[model samples]
Target: MAKHNIYKMSVSEVYPHYITKAEKKGRTKEEVDEIIIWLTGYTQAQLDKELEKKTDFETFFVNAPNMNPARTLIKGVICGIRVEDIEEPIMKEIRYLDKLVDELAKGKSMDKILRK
Candidate 1:
């Protein structure tokens, strides 16, 4: 199988889809933003700026203000792959965010989603 070029994909392009998924499931965009902030430690303002800049995923993650150390505790399957088992660090981080969003859309409590 061919590898995906996720690094070349813009976070801006993907973020709105995440919001839509949450909203369709009766979750708010603010909730989506909150989970993102929790995972990446990016303030709302910084996240907005990155979205406006249309930076690729690689740059967006690389420039994150602070990655929460507790994020390693996030464990689950995403796209049939266990996030904790992902070999690539960047892919693992991206999957961690995906899993958090999945939990949010599934109406998991914010405390639980944040792994409290």
Candidate 2:
């Protein structure tokens, strides 16, 4: 059996209210999961932690240790959890910086495009 971030068997047997591009496009949950895994590099637990912090729509520029400032954070309610978006140009720069740390960890990088 393979591991999954959003749909770990331990979490639940069903994902309610979760709407994703994958879902909209009629992609399998596993396929969508792959894209998420590719970007977040989260090993289930870590992903859950980030997901836990999100509870509403909030945008900000984050500059932590070893990070470049100018990233736009777009986090909001998605299937009830807070999902972050960093697709804005400002955030892309931050994503690039984070990616520099480890090319393999780009999956978890914050660089989601804002829907609005």
Q: Could you give me the TM-score of model 1 versus the true structure?
A: 0.95
What's the TM-score of every candidate structure?
Answer: 0.95, 0.31
- The worst-scoring run of ten residues by lDDT in candidate 2 lies at 55-64
- Candidate-wise lDDT, in order: 0.90, 0.32
Clash tally for model 2: 10
- Position 91, candidate 2: lDDT: 36
TM-score, cand. 2: 0.31
lDDT of 2 at 46: 41
Candidate No. with top TM-score: 1
Residue pairs in clash, model 1: none
On residues 1-116, what C-alpha lDDT tens digit does candidate 2 reach at each position? 44223222221222222224335545444443333334334445543444464411111112111222222243343334333443344334323323322221323322332111
Give me the displacement of residue 40 in model 1, in angstroms.
Answer: 0.8
